[model samples]
Target chain A: MAAIPEALAELVSDMESISDRNERAELLIETADRFGDFRVPASIASKPYPEDHRVKACESDAYVWAVDRPDGTLDFYFDVLNPQGLSAMAMSTILAETLNGQPLDSVAAVNSEIVFKLFGKDLSMGKGAGLMGIISVVQTEAKKRLAAR
Target chain B: MSVSITERGYVNPGVLVSTDWVAEHQQDANVRIIESNEDPLLYSAGHIAGAVQVDWTRDLNDQLRRDYLNKASFEALMSRIGVTHDTTIVLYGDKNNWWATYAFWVFQLFGHTNAKVMDGGRAKWEKEGRPLTREIPAYAPTAYTAPERDDASIRAFRDQVLKHVEAGGPLVDVRSPAEYTGEKLHMPEYPQEGAIRGGHIPGAKSVPWARAVNTEDGTFKPAEELKQIYEQEQGLDPNSELIAYCRIGERSSHTWFVLTYLLGFKNVKNYDGSWTEWGNLVGVPIEK
Candidate 1:
């Protein structure tokens, strides 16, 4: 198993640090805001993001675009505007913020569900559980990227 | 059956009115429209006019217990949500009304028999270009009478489910096909496998929750079709002692609503502990 990317591990640690359910929800909302704005290529600007890597089983339409920068780190852009609002966006945002600048293996290393247990009750475990779909597809893409090279 | 009754089912069927009915009845002194979405935030995005939001996690569930709220707190919630004993509530929301049906089941647990689930849920209403708004409705509180939450008739505990299973009684495992066979325990469960012990309770039938509803509209299939599928295609004995389960019981609530109200079957209990309990038990019999 690949080791967790450092930045992502810290986010998981912070999430684990909050034992209070209410405080965890507050932190989740704050974390959702951590991803500032959406961006995409000019070509598909008016089109739907290719369903090339579909996040199945999740209720929302979530997708990840893989971009391997010249620095040998694989960056990912996320279009995870879950129709639900904060809870839906929170899990996606955490993955986007943590995995954006990491290498392919680092992205592959991520068992992103580390953050799943931190939410529920006042907010809901389902909210954070939304990340499960993204986690599977993202790591699958990373594996393909590594195999091709 | 009329579309209104088809969507809402026949038991206390008056609660199952049309969206057009909701549109006309919004101002009706006795009606309340409540949106209970899987995504709690979707209510603020846009909702049917005169509807209130019920966040299952924040509103219906008890803060501390794995169980639902107690009767006194349930009364307070009714008051908080502007629901009175006599109010006829119609519930609709995302996830093909999965969460909405679960919400309806929770209300029934408190003996709030006036509630009905919207047919086709939010997806159908939105598909038809029905009017939606960001506005939330407010209502005056009434002295809501709390029912002594009757669990025996509707709910099945772990022991009951085990006994039912051991007796070769009817059981419906309403999870995805993969989950029922232990081929995959992927989605809708906690963390992952959620159970170190995968597979299903022995002798359970795999009738996925999705089969009960039309994928396009989220409305249940016609009653005849539902009967054909549940009774004939699946061979579920409607008159037998029956129970349904999913990972945590939410999905099964959808099935429970269908079997009890739509199909009008009696003696059905939703095993709320479901696979989460059965799969994890050390000594329970499991089938892959």
Candidate 2:
């Protein structure tokens, strides 16, 4: 496996350290509360996003966009259409925070198992798929960028 | 404007409570407002004031098996949540009360008949500018006792579903049209919950679960509209023994609640194993 991004690996480590479910929940909730700050800007994308950009199997109607940075790294932005989709929002926020500006190879190497590490194994299969879908889109974007080079 | 819960002409209108009703009763000692959600982080982020969280997986399900909690565990859960035998459970959550109705179905397994779902659920409550709090409330534990779970009345197992299929009994496939047609298989990444085979049970009618609710605000459609969808559109017989199934039964439980309570279907059961079990079973009749 390719090396995990430093920031994402650190975040996963921090989450894994907390044994209490409530504490982990509080952390995730706090992260989700910051979702607005990481939302896709109108300048990059807007309402009625294209179907191609939408995450598959995600009930939250989440959309992901990767903007090319001048230095060849990517800046990821996400929009979760369902307002009650807090988990999707949190996953988006985490991806934006940890994956943005990372090496394309490292970002692409990030696996879906990180979802379980960050959110815990108790996530329902549907919920797990949705969260992993967000990561899959992000990694796909990174892989596309690397291949283009 | 949507019609009030009572004016919706449901046969069992008492099974649904509006956000307004919940607002007035948030402080009622006899009512326990429980928020059960699919998103694990939602309850901790913010929820209705005085409402306690009952996680669908942790609080309701059996930790060791795929089944639900037993009688002793149910009693322990009630005691932990400070609910008595008479404490009314008003369940609401995200996904248009999908998880809420699912929790309601589990409560029924334990024979908690006093439970009702909050129409429209957390979205409506939040959209209406109702107050939500992160402050979890603590209620003194109560001496709650529950009878053994009765799976016969409203639940269907794999064998029963097979028998029903053989008998040509009426069944409702509450999944999306793609899932019903077997055009969409389970996500390969999550194999444990995925079905190797696609398609639905034989002789099942495809009426997506969301048809029972209004998409604008996630409220159950008025009884007239529901009847048109279930009866007129799909030709489901209200008097017959009907079984509803979705991927894992959570979505179908919403349908079970609708047919059993809203449309007043006399006999409705939720096949919790649903497509996952049926699709994987050997030699079961399947229809795409």
Candidate 3:
């Protein structure tokens, strides 16, 4: 199995250390607040994004974009159409922050279980699936890139 | 330019309040605005000013078992939220009030009938450019005493559902068509399989819950249109005993609210065990 990306592993470790639900929520809210920084720019994509890029089973209407970098790594961008989809935004922000510019093989190996680590075990089924769908899209992009190589 | 809740011709329009009503009542001591959401981060990010959050998983569900909080926990939750018996609880949340309605259903189990759902929920409120704040308000705890949960009236267990199926009673499958037809076992890319089996209970009418609401603003469709879908098109008798179910009953609660409050269905119940329990149970009938 491919090793988990270094940055993502560190984030999972950091998040897993926090025991308080409120504290974890605050941290995630803080991360969601940074969503604007990693949104898919107009140059990369725009409204009416292709349906193929849309994350299936995500009620939040999330879309993912991946741009290949010079060093054979990928830079990811995301847009969640639902303004109230804060969880999706947070997940997207985390993926962009940790997986961007990572080696393709390692990025493809990032497991969706990180969602439970970051959000805790109490996540509702629907919300958990939607957040994991975001991760799945990111992983799928990395795998597609690897196949092209 | 949608019709107002009262003008929508609902049988129980009083159960729904507009955003304007909420804005005026935010400071009303008798009214407590509660936001219940599927996403845990939304409440902390920002919410209607002075509104308290009731998380479905944490506050409403039992910690150890796959059940809701017991009487003592219910009273404690009410106390923490500073709600008295007479306080008019107004609920709203993200996902077009899916969690809000589920919260409403749970509150009903405790006989807290003095509650209203904010029409269109958080999406409508936000689209109208209402203000939201991150400051969580602190309220004095109230001495709340709740009755033991009465599950018989509006909740359906697996056995009851099987009986209903055997008796040819009406059931509404409020999940997506893919789930109803067993084309997909669960939502796409969802890691957990909802059930070992797929398809739906026998004799269930396929009525996706979203059909009851206008997708543009997430407000419920006018009662006439709703009647057309549930009564005329689906052939559901509003006066007959009916049960609604989804993957785990959250979405069905939305449909339950629609059938009971909006259309005044006389004998409607939410099969809370829903497809997750029914699909996996042995010897139960399933139809694609």
- For model 3, what TM-score does chain A reach? 0.96
Report the C-alpha lDDT of model 3 over A1-149, residue by residue, as the tens digit: 89988888998999999999889989988999899999999999888899988998688899999999999999999999988888899999999999989889999999887899999987877778888889998999899888887
Ten-residue region with minimum lDDT total, candidate 1 chain B:
B1-10
Clashes of each: 2, 0, 0
Q: Which candidate tops DockQ? A: 2
lDDT of 2 by residue, B58-174 (tens): 998899998999999999999999999799999999989999999999999988999999999999999999889999999999998899999999999999988998998999999
Write out fnat for all predictions, comma-separated. 0.26, 0.89, 0.89
User: Candidate 1's residue-wise lDDT over B126-173, tens digit each?
Assistant: 878888886767788767879878889889999888788789888899
**Which model is ahead, 1 or 3, in terms of TM-score?**
3
lDDT of 2 by residue, A1-149 (tens): 57978989999999988899999999998899899988999998878898999998688999999999999999999999988788899999999999889899999999987888898888888899999999999999999999988
Candidate 3, Cα interface RMSD: 2.2
The per-residue C-alpha lDDT of model 1 at residue B208 equals 92
Tens-place lDDT per residue, model 3, B37-156, is: 988888888899989999888899998887889999999999999999999999999888999999999999999999999999998999999899989999999999999999899999
Docking class of 2: high
DockQ of each: 0.27, 0.84, 0.72
Give the higher-DockQ candidate: 2 or 3.
2
